[model samples]
Target: MKKRLIGALLALTFCVPATAGDITPRLSPTPEQAQAAYLSAMFLSRYHYTVKPLDDALSEQIFERYLKALDPEHLFLTQADIDAFADTRKQLDDAILQGRLSIPFALFLRYEERTAERLGYARSLLAQNFDFSQNEHYPLDRSKAAWLKDDAEARDLWRKRVKNDWLRLRLAGKDAAAIRETLDKRYTRLLANSQKSKSDDVFQTFMNAYAGAIEPHTSYLGRGSAESFDIAMRLSLVGIGAVLQERDEYITIRELSPGGPAIRSGKLAVGDRIVAVGQGDGAPLTDVVGTRVEEVVKLIRGTKDTPVVLDILPADAGPDGRHTLITLIRDKIRMEEQAAKKSVLPAGDGRRIGVITLPTFYEDFEGRRRGDKDYRSASRDVARLIDELKQDKVDGLILDLRNNGGGSLREAVDLTGLFIDTGPVVQQRRADGKINVESDSKAGAAWDGPMAVMINRGSASASEILAAALQDHGRALIVGEPSFGKGTVQSLINLDQVARSDTPKLGELKVTVAQFFRVNGGTTQLKGVTPDIRFPSAFEGDEFGETRFDNALPWRQIDPATYRPANEIRAILPELTSRHATRANQDKAFANLREDVAELIKLKEKRNLSLQEAERKREKDSREARLRTRAEADGTAGPGDDGLQSSERSLSAELAAEKAFKARKDVLLEETARIVGDEVSLLAGSKRLAVGN
Candidate 1:
């Protein structure tokens, strides 16, 4: 197998563009090159798993899919070019099937030339228009239509755009020489960073193209990204915990950390685009469109307690999107924010339910690396929390993994152990088809009380593993929406380890070399774990599930592992479902949640418009005029009617009443605590059996 793999890699090197710099240059493939590379790599990899040797027909199909992904609209390719490429398709297919890596250097050179030409064109535009206000303004979705049609047209548009951009920057009082220097420096850094990546650039590129062909959510994490993954799992960063990705010219929000300032503010949404950022009030907002994610991160992150304001253009806003200035005070991330937070909820009929909200299975990597005696790990923390909850004498436990994207696999297994006697928590099936059963590897159950695990479309990976294990073993009742169905396991292989020398600077590559299977022989691939009692979640749209993703692995079953049911949890599920339904229907908070989701859906569906369509927009905007007018009026108004008839009136009687109410609420934390305590007592029914007792 190793020999075959090495043979394949050698063949791949021949197909890949050769390194041309003192340091091995990791280059981006042109549209044509990307299509060829993607086809060859995907076919080879899939064939390695499915067939004894690569087949010619499969290679042709792979080529077709690759081309379709790269140029689906067929706008970029002319009839002659398509015909010419089609004529050579057979030979290319044979080369890939035969594992003949030696593609002509001329082809690679062409790819290099194309890439250089594109970069040079982009640089020319930057040279001409630094400010970029007037080249051509089109909606993000329409950008490809406008610019990526033909080389000549694209070049012309870029030239004009760049000229206008530079003019604007000059107008803004930036020195041209300094700007040029900065650009050069940034480009150098980017190239250097790319070179430092340890993973095979060709393979990483193939994965990226494969992911792009599938869906936005499916991504291949290169070696450099493994560090990022570690950071994400740890939930610790110097900057604001918002992940952004370039979608067209704008940087779109990819994910929001559970306890990040952005989530706390409740203003920034996943689809919002960041246009500009300011260091402080009245500071010039720097346009960051088309900037690298790292540069954007640098701009957004600041020293603790320093405020950085972002001018966001929400996806739902019109073409010239409305600007929302969000101010966040930066600080070092707290690991606890990403851990499970425990609370006692009144589950009526004298039952105090322990609610453990697992935001994400987090681990403090930096602290652990530093050998801190009290370094935090998710499983340990959760285990302690479960013990505490048990001591509180809670009758039932609700492990809420809603919106959790998963984390450390070890932690997941350990967390699952807390519910049942030691058993296999998950099955890891490697590329070689060897299945490793990962068991609890720990002592007795921490809290074996009636358990309900809540999941949603966002509950993925390790989260899915835990939920599926608990449900399969009858240790818990799965509730809420279906899990995210990301059952693959990615192993972060340090490129440095593979390198010939220790000081070699190649980064890392996190490849999905294995797929996870559940103890019951079920794989949570495209078919996620279905809840025992499904509940409505905010993200229930048709487009949001794993099933919507193209190329997602199909769900299958394996042999179920033997395990004893912790308790008769299913018998109580029906009653629990009924009770939850009744309570949810009557709960004001739940109603509010539904309303919020509806409103958010409405907001996200809005689109951009041309200046000519502004009038029509205004007509539509009139219906919302009352709300806008009320807000505008509120900005200038004092407290209430003071009968002074002045432009700005003093605080009024009604205003005083509102302020008094706010003050009372502010001082009523103790009262609120007392109320919660009473509710807890009433729910527990004087059990005196555990901790709260």
Candidate 2:
């Protein structure tokens, strides 16, 4: 997840505390903070895989990153403010090495001042009536927009912004008085949150900026952030199963955990911005814009079986789009909920196709360590499922890994063992140029019939490894969109453990120390695995993978590992591709999928929104209607299904849910299955012809 430039004001004086109406002290770096900086510099320079020098060039990148992190939308800081800190760009290396951070802290304080100014101006604008009839458009995504030259330019932008905010509420059926009250409270809270920023926040923000400038995946986690990471790793977070990151003053959903309420509800999506949170049906919504991600998490977390209402700005909806209120019950997402499951679809000529949807490549590390015979592991589960499917007389299989953001690396290699006899699966290259090959030595195939591995943009890391290995060995036909290119591996280094100082606490630095490669030699870094049979993708390559990151590692190649092809799947590609294309064209569900993908692409490309009230309302209503129509056609719940929903289920309920999912019209899955069915028939024909010859 991309870290947000969170936290507001910095405190300068260490011993002083703020009283009511007193000027809050500016944030400054302490001796401990300086020690951390020096240590971080040493570790990153010496140990990071990329080995980038902490020189003037890197210092400049860090400077730019920090500035952008502070004001991503260019709403708070002006060009003057940037110019004032121009000289510090190249000098940051010296500052970091010497443990001096006054300039960085000063810049953060300037941002806080600007935020207060902008919010005050916005509040003042709420008192007056907006000319909503004007046809001017507001830029929705201003991350790449030019910085404001002066205060006048900033005010003009803020004026349009205030009008846009008001217009959105008015179109959402809120009264003028209610809109006014909400805006007032929102602005007040935003200002207060800015003032409430602590020294740790500033240190974290700057350190992350430094780390991110070197590599996109690297980050410095504070104590609280570290604890959250542990909670997420343990899957103990009792909340709406949504992974959020603060960006551009909004708490945006980055990913959804499988079997989580956020995903099960099907209302929330990646890139959606959560603007407000309500405790229950009767509680008032607390505004979350410009708030810290930690605080937002606290607001969303609740006891199991309790309801949480979220006011969200839909990802596909442009800036002027109406807010959607979705209610979901909090619950713990168990490993079983994301385990591999099997289904059988009958094909022509008694060719039954088995589909196994693997959410993530997971394993019970502790259970395995304890020598449990029946320990929960993706490979074991999949092997068992394959056995069951074989007994059901299935001729082919489809490994559905659409949204599996990979988990266990060992499981990936072990899972590969189920297909190939024995060979190297993947190779890892460390910072010192040492390459280690991870192989599956165990022999014998689990179910080596005609098979396909399905992946999408969200399929990453270990997913890419497994898919690439299969593709390399000709073991399975790869299908669907390109995988998420995330070949680099990161390890968290606790600063306190390695620090020379006796300081009680420091932070943790997650650094990319190695990169993994496919058995075929190429790394899935910037270039993910390309499918043998491609499908229409709603997400563009540059918008949704490693390529989206500014400083991600580049794809590289090495000497291919010695491994024999498992089958001659590539020889029959032309026939399979032709048949799949014909079937996709004739399939109504596939056509609908293409149309929906095209619509989503268009929506994602929308950069501006009509500020005119009537025009905006028409657009929002039309979009909503189109979505509702699509949902109905796809056999999903429409806007009318916004009541409280829970995904927690009993054994019977789980079975029912699985049945319903299989019955649902998933165009992509259906098409993939048809492609596999075509392959099965084609291969069978080849075998018959061979026998006759």
Candidate 3:
């Protein structure tokens, strides 16, 4: 296989692009980057689950994906600029294979030029008064829109964009003078960030373009990112404890580390955008709208106990929304903080349902390797938690895996063993078509009574493996929405291992090496583990999760693994579903949650918003009113009487938001407990009937 792979790569003709215009690059690719590029290409081509060739077809894909990666919203780079690089459209494969990065670097130089010009134009518009009374609409999502035809078209879009930016602040209650200063500083900072782009940035972007063109999960981890990944693995992140991603011009929160300040404060959430950041109290806010992700990370990261204040644009709030200031002290996220926690909810009739919230399938690999008797692992932690719950005399259990973005695979398998005797839990199929089964080798069950596993769109990888095993074994009822649907397994290839002694330190290649499946013959790749009883979800259709990625692998099935089913939950699932529906419809919190989710879905589907101030105000007011009503219904304090329209930071308002946030989170869990209550009742009735028979 190795010989054949090398032969295919060598068969491709390597070529180079001519020097691009008189424009001098602020940063140029080094020999190290070239070597990294070649190494990434070779590894991705050989080990990636999908075996597409490195030819013209993939080259064109790389070109388009690279353009998208640079300007995802099509806000910059005119048609003329795109046309200038037409010659290199089908040559990226050859260039990347040979470690020649002239074309990509040249393209990046042009992108940098365009970015500076655009920001300059945007800043120039700050002096002019926008006619907010005019009935114009700004396209909120331009990801699928066509690129600008020329410089004239680009300026026109910028005019509207600048107008929209101005109006957002105005509606949020900023004076014209303050708005002008804020926007000017924002654009200036953006231009400065553009000029600060380095050679490594260009290489990382281009390599990711090549990687994402093949698969969504696979990518090249540059030196900086590689170091961050290592730090996270060591469980010693210091800062706000938020995982951020660069989306369009904003650094958006992607995930929050469990037990971290972000989650503890309950102010930040997935999808909130950090617009500006400050140090301590009353420090000057540094606008980070268009800053590099790593740069923003540096700004956010500091010594423990130092406070960082983030000016946040809440996710539900559109680009034209109010900003809230959230202050959090920097602290290290330790292993003990991320350990599993348990709680018990009364289910009437003196019965209790135990809930175990496992943030990730974590394990102390170093401790285990050193043969430490007290090595921390998800299975071990959960086993101890189960013992505590058993001592509490719980009648049922709920394994809450919502927002748990997966972790140790060994722990997932071992955790499965706790509820089932030795059996195959999951299967993996490699690129070479070799299938391997991972099974639970232990005997006996831990609290094998009525149980359910709760999952959501954030649950993935190891989480999917465990949920699938439980569902397939008929050991637990899968509840809530479908999981993240990441069935492909990625293995990191350290490029430094293949480098010569004198070669510059290299980065790593995270490639999709295999696809995993459930034991019941079906792969979870695209179609994640579907719940037997689904709850009302904010996400609909293919709007989120793995289905959102066009390059994601397709779902398929293989031969089922040999295993014995424990208890048939399917037999009583329909009855459980009916009971859940009846209770959820009657419950006030559940009804409010359904309404909130429906509103969120609408917001997600909205692609355009009125540029008119009056119209926008009416819309914003109506939305905030609903939020206030939802909070009132939940018996929690909300954004005061004026709502979240105020941009000023208020201790009272912050407290209200925290209360509302916690209440919203509990809505789902409370309903899940009710469903589990139904399970306990049904199972009890079934056994009683059996005894009578």
Candidate 4:
């Protein structure tokens, strides 16, 4: 198998010839560091999917990506400043090979000055008053916006930015003094964070830029981030088990740990902006905006069983969205907590339906390697639940993979084997240009009653594998939005291990080592698996997928493996599609969802966001009113309102979570159960024998 992996050989790529008198860096790498870089370059060039040349083109891209990473919002560096680094850009290849970090350090020093200047301007706005009535706009999502021509243009942008910040807070029920205080505190904290950037941090940032240009998954992990990554993997740290990253002045929750307190709470969600954090009930939720992530993280961390209240602004809400306070008990991640959870859904004819929400494709590799008799994995847990559900005589099953970012490749194969009698589960393409068919040679099906798999944009990697395999085998109907397209495999290589370094730590590199393909030879790279019954996606844009990266590995195909369809889903897709549309039209929640999705799309398309307080307030009010009306009809409260018909107490995190997981009102799940019911009907309607009969 190892021999099948092909390495691409580049004639001119071994090393760049070192020249004398290179600009000395402020924080230079040692000879050992230089060797690590050379080794990494060679490893990536040979193994990376693109095998892009190490010439001037890639060098230019590395510089561009580096700059973008540091100042993505283009608030700091100007167009003129970028142009000044053009010569430095071309010399990156040589710099990287020769262990010269001077160019990147020079750029970073300029970035530091730029940040100080921007922060000073922001702080200056606190002393001045602005008219809330002015019809102004702010370019909120300026990721693609051109850099400022000069400092004057930047100041103009920053002025509106200041007003926009003021308006958002004001709309959120703060007064002028409070707003100024918040902005002042935020800027001061930000300035401090800027000052704290170490040379290692800058080096990691620069290296990641180079790595990311190779592929989206490839990244350089600094010592701090690497340590954090290790902690997350071990699941030992106690806190709200949510992975977060800084995005445009907010710490956004990326993925929730499957069995963590966060996921079980079900109140916290991906893309939720954590604007504030506080201790157990009664504490004021202090705003965390513009604060260093570590400071925010420290505030959230606490002892086990202790509650933390997070004031979050959900991603889908308006810019001045209602802050939803969610409380969660801090606890270590337990396997049982995160394992496949089962609940019964109602079928139309007084029958029960089984729904298994698998948060991730988990596996205890160490236990398995030690040959433990009772090892935990997604397949094992799911197989047990299937037995219990079958005992309950469920008419059908729905496997919920929503927000499942995926894990454990072995589990994806093992889990897929539970459904099919015998077939290939997935195909893996290595650097050698050969495809490895990972197969299931077993001969018996598991539960096999009418089944449906539910997924969304967050479903990725192993999640995509299982969904694509089931879909390919005609075993289960898939539901929800297109899955997150992250098919490539990442291998973490510690750079310090690459070249022995005792004095200076070299951190680690997460390199995209391989690409995953469906058993049918289709790659789930950028174009994730299309659900059989499509649902209106909450993530209306491409911001959440592998395709969002500028240099993501392109989707490719291989020869179809020898296989046959196990069932006839294609024949019933028309019937399912028709029924789904009809139900969506009649279902009020579904209708509301569709409208929400449309609004989100419009928001995504807008190049500029309104800074005018009245306009912003109008949009926010309209959205809230619509939601409140819907909530009233359902006999529940909406945003900023308690769930009870009448109550003195505010919403607790536990109650809020229970309110959310009320399955009947979960339009997505409701429709999923209905779809599974349809699949059950299809099974009954067909002449073919029911699976596992």
Candidate 5:
């Protein structure tokens, strides 16, 4: 099945236009196309200086790719336009071939006009009650929303959003009069920026959509902005350790890094809206409503120990608004916290267990590029860790690959070899119908112990490969939530090679090139790998998985490859499962987890704001009641201890619960160790019996 999938993907590479039956017909270049190309050339000329001689051919290709990305369904361009663009395409190609130094400015104006027109249309659509709050805590049903039914209402909403955006630009210090005066000049400069940025954005978007279409693991990162580049290179950012997304006019926290200031503060919740920001006490709050995401990010981020205050609009806040001012001290992000870490668990049965938490399969590419031998690579480090664990005489190993977004294909294959003996790890199929089998070439396994893999919706790409391969080969039992289904391959193509100019310049392009399949013939595209024993995880919402994607490839299976099981680990599967079930059923930690999930769900359901005076009071009362309930449930106070009051007892209990939870996880490790020990003993017994007979 893996081979077939690879073959199919490869076939797409060389497929002629004639063979792409029912595909939207290619349109000729429009005036917009010519302008877009010219802008791209200008951007490339300014920033990308390594590849001298920007040319028309390269620009034409970039334009065509950009157009295709913008209108993949072929709904925007007509056949006549396609034909009309032919000459322009050829002219661009010829100029690129000759390495032309100059491009006309008139082309940039057309590009600007087209882009603004398109953005205007998008802005107009955003006005209606399309419900930007779908992924927020109070998830809205667009069908039930009255605003969605009225086009006028929707357009008005978008217009207001646009107005707010302009206001934000002004706040960012853009002089209104100067902006008006330099509109043409800025557009001209932006045309060049846009051209360069278009190539970068289009390539990145395509990679994202393509990887997302294949599975969630595969992703593309074009050359980032100067700020982003600095962050990636340094593996650090100055901000509260959280990723934010815009839903409607509010900024919502999307991801929280472990041990980050936001997580440590215990104040800001995932669904809370950041409505305003202030520098310090007595500073007037700056309303950040409807701001561009990056601009907002800049305001929030700062150097370590510098404080930034946020006016948080809780998910359930009413119109009069119940907001909290949260001041967080910015700090340098710790890359080590984001990488894989190891822990040792001591079982009551005198067995030792090794647990490894893999946050992500991250690679410091810039570090690698600079020829750093000790630069972090997930697979290499993991393999070394496994060896160290074995040397420490650990009886079992639990690989926590939860929330791992894959990196480096080579690393994934190598990691798979650590668990399984020589076998095909994954199959890669290209667009030209070629299938390549990625395999583990190693001779021996690193840790042949009782092994289990923990996964969640965030586990993708190479993470999927390791989990799927282990499960398929019967090497490990998968636990926790289902893995993120993301099985695609991307290739980074340097556009500098094709540029047409003497001033070494051209951006890079990342294109989706293939799809990946596991050894058992299943593609973890839309439906991620289901765990052997499912456990509730942090990402329970619908928005985080591949199913949320509109164009994700459907999950399918092919013929399984021939491979022998390392050992009959399944013989003790029943006992292991029974033990786990018993432990979980009686586990207070598990019980608390369930309660937490329920409370979160309830909190997320609140939406409508109270407008009337009486209603506002009621709303406030209701919010207070909910908060009290939450405090009581999660607080440390316990029942009747003379020295400690109820509040103190609740705090003590909470602390105890955390300690117990960690202990319970260790118990789980011990149980796995016992299972592995039993298996090893049974094998020895059978061998002795056979010899005696």
Candidate 6:
């Protein structure tokens, strides 16, 4: 998970009595908070998915995990810092019980100081003109690198870092002055943002670390964050449809929701920072740097159809560069956006099959509580789409769950009902090892015709459940990369609910209370659901999924549930594999995807980056060429709209959006269509053979 940036008005300071720095620190959780931690621990040990003792060994593990969490890249904390905190490494468990969080707080103060010092060093390097002509290599990903012995080693690293930063910008057509200016502002803002961490921020960070030590998905939400989580669970809000989060002092777009204005407009993207916002024509874009993202949201949000302009710093661009302004007309949950929508893909055999792209398994809990019959959810929308597609006489259907991080679990169960005719879909194993089967209670299948379920690394949780159900039942052909293997179910336990008195609001604990299993008794925990037909994953050899997590629950299984599979596709997998191979070799898009994946694999191995100006430029040019080729092949709007992580220039939101939407289409869907067509033919052939026999 990306580091959740906790920031607000830097001006508002939280007072705490302490001795860490000139600014005293709030070094302990409140009496209620301490109680909350204990209550949470008791609940976790008693009711979590796989309970474990809060023993000395667990405490030691938690301590190390917390330290690593503080500095995953080994950038801020040094060896000395690690040694200094080693004493408390085995003490966090005891401290949590006592409501004393002084150790984590102290460590954070040191991290803040060290971070500020690094930024200071970075700032100082801006004065010295960089000599990129020197032959040197700077490490880009320092996750595996060792912590520095001292500040001198750290300063040397920072100097190279500054040079690398300058070299990259210069290669990207930025002048020396411009590069310096960008780094100056970036470092300055970064430092200022570091200082703005309040007690809530510290508590949230430490508690998250504490909770994460138990399991990756489990977390303790502070009062503010708990409220935010509530607001986010709602499906509709009038805005650009871009989820923004505070990332390194800049309000950056986190994810673009399918069918949202930002997604439709195409200008905004994940990591693009909103530097400013404007309302109406000719209105000046007001700078939003250092402002609370909530405040920024208020500024950008308005009544439906109102034009909002955003001055954005393209994701990888320098801060000093001129920003691109994107104009969007916000709407209140536009029917097209967030709703399950369908498109038709025609195969070479002249058969048209419908593809339903489900971005998330979203459910309107509030509307449902209010008894609104038309409350939106993934199942209902998909059911309606299925009905529409049936009217079109489509050959088959594809559930496109690519990039679909699962939402509501109930939605997944209900959606599975639309396919399977009254059978068990998934089984939940609780902490006590009791199994509860969630089955499709409905009598008949919504559409019994041939179907395909498309998935990728981003398809997770509820998405996994749906895809697995369809696959396990042989109701749908599973296509694409391995799904994000999240097998655990998180249940929210309000700490305040545990308390009887009216006091300061204790936060909530999102704990992994149950593990999900397929009806076949196979657990999808660490080794997510592997598709029957595989695509060359760009994620190959990378540590990005469940298996990469620290102390993740291991793969396990129990007695198979008592339910029969609809059809065992395993028998035809070899033939399917051979056919897929033949098709991929003949297809240009698959060839490109293979080459890109190979390049990615090679790039992953090449960690050290050349700092020589010529080498850097050559590398940049090569990358840009690849991106341009991909853009041309994908027929996207521009180089930026292609799947490249970095781009040369800023793009207008509208243009960017157009190309982005275009870029979303690729060989994967086309192949799935062909596969679906093959299934249709196979079904027809089987019927004829049966009749003849």
Which candidate should be chosen as best, given lDDT against the real structure? 3
Question: Cα deviation in Å at residue 123, candidate 1?
Answer: 18
lDDT of 6 by residue, 576-612 (tens): 6788889999987788878878988888888899989
The CA lDDT at 587 in model 2 is 74
- Determine the C-alpha RMSD for candidate 3 after optimal superposition of all C-alphas: 8.1
TM-scores for all candidates? 0.56, 0.74, 0.80, 0.78, 0.53, 0.81
lDDT of 3 by residue, 1-693 (tens): 355644454433132123222334476777677767776776677667897778899999999999999999999998899999999999998787666678898999899989989999999888888888988878888988999899998998899988887877887787989889878866776687678787788889999999999999898888888867655444466787887876656898877888889999999998799999999889999999878888899899889999999999998898999999999999976645567899999877777999999988877666789998976678888999999999999989999999888877788899988877578989999988899999876666676778889999989999999999889888888999999899988777666655532542568888888888899989777788899998889874376789889889988899999886755477888899998888887888777777778888887778887888888888888977877776676654244333123223233454466566766558777777877888888788543110000
Report the C-alpha lDDT of model 5 over 1-693, residue by residue, as the tens digit: 134433433333222121111111221222222222333333234322122244554445544543455545332233443554556554543332232312212232333444554345544443333232222121223322332223344344334433333332333355555333333333333333333333335334433432233223334344445346445434567788877765544676756777888989999876677888887667788888766567678888887888889999876676468889999988877666656678777654576768788766656666678998877667767887887888888877788886677666777887878877678888876646467788887776776656788777878878888888887777887777887777776554333333322432333433455778888777887777888777655465256777765555556666656566544556666766676678667766556566556765665565532223344345445655655664586552222212221222333354465566555433334444444444444344432110000
lDDT of each: 0.58, 0.80, 0.81, 0.77, 0.56, 0.76
Off by over 4 Å in 5: 1-222, 225-334, 364-372, 500-506, 537-542, 601-693
Give the lDDT of residue 27 in candidate 6.
Answer: 44
Writing each residue's lDDT as its tens digit, candidate 2 over 1-693 gives 122211110111122222211123677767667767776787788678898999999999999999889999889999998999999899888888766777788889999999999999999998899898887888888888888999999999999988888887787777888888877877776787788788888889999999999998888988678766655343355788887876556788877888899999988888899999999887899998878888899899879999999999987777778999999999975545567899987666666789999988877666688998866788998999999998888888999999898877889999988887778889999878889999988766786678899999999988999999988888889999999999988777776656423544677888888999998889999889999999998886688899989889888899888777644588889889998889888876777778778887887788887889888777777877876777777655333211111221222344466577767767777777778888887687443110000
- In angstroms, give how far residue 662 of model 4 lies from its true place: 9.7
Arrange candidates, best lDDT first: 3, 2, 4, 6, 1, 5
Taking all chains together, the TM-score of candidate 1 against the true structure is 0.56
| Residue pairs whose backbone atoms clash in candidate 6 | 265-657, 266-656, 266-657, 267-653, 267-657, 637-659
Clashes of each: 24, 5, 0, 4, 52, 6
| Candidate 5 TM-score over all chains jointly | 0.53
Order by TM-score, highest first: 6, 3, 4, 2, 1, 5
> Which scores higher on lDDT, 1 or 5?
1
Q: RMSD for all candidates, in order, please.
A: 13.4, 10.2, 8.1, 8.7, 14.7, 7.9
Q: After superposition, how far is residue 310 of candidate 4 from its true place, in Å?
A: 22
